[model samples]
Target: MKRKEKFENRKTVRKTECRRSRNLGSCPAAEVSKLQKTVNSFAYTLEKAHFLDYVQYASNEKRIFRRAFLTGLLRGFGTAVGVTVLGAVIIYLFQALAKSNLPYIADFISDIIDIIEKTRK
Candidate 1:
């Protein structure tokens, strides 16, 4: 009966105990301390189970979606612009090389284009 009383009372909140009795000197203090520790640990764990709440605590769905979409669209746009600039540079180089005094340079460029076309096949 005493053990059941003690167990029920153990889970309830109370102040730090310092009571003393025969055959149980300092034992109540230990029991109270252990119960308090368990309570504290449970409270701490309860505070952390809100995973989704923590993630969406300060974020709006529309804002996140807008940022992601704009980022991807801008990335794709920049890549297309970069490829166009690179192709222009290559064409300009080929035109300059064709007008040069070296006669074999044009043949070399044509051969390279042929090789590229063959690879596509």
Candidate 2:
């Protein structure tokens, strides 16, 4: 019993020593530290992979598809609103410029308007 207990204690100590050497840097400190960092990075990567797996398993494909569809729909709506606002601002700017008493500017505006009308026809 004593011999068996001694062997078991030594085995446990060896396991702990290995872990301690990895974590607390007993020897080959720099290399061990790099390895520990890499192991920690892998741990994080594994956690992320698990999280993604859970997300995939818990959510149906229809849910994911709806999420993607809504995202695209919102994006398209934003683009349309942005273009409308931009066109309104441009028209307001041109109208403001037309109101100014600059003869050359008025002629330029009339020429632009004529070109637009020609395009419409």
The most accurate candidate by lDDT is 2
lDDT of each: 0.72, 0.78
Q: How much is the lDDT of residue 59 in candidate 1?
A: 74
* True lDDT of residue 71, candidate 1: 100
TM-scores for all candidates?
0.42, 0.51
Residues 1-121, candidate 1: write the lDDT tens digits: 6998997787553322433333445455667678679999987886788756756854788878888899999999999999999987986787677567477888787666667668779
Least lDDT summed over 10 consecutive residues: which range in candidate 1? Answer: 13-22
Local distance difference test, candidate 2: 0.78
As for model 2, its CA RMSD to the true structure in angstroms is 10.9
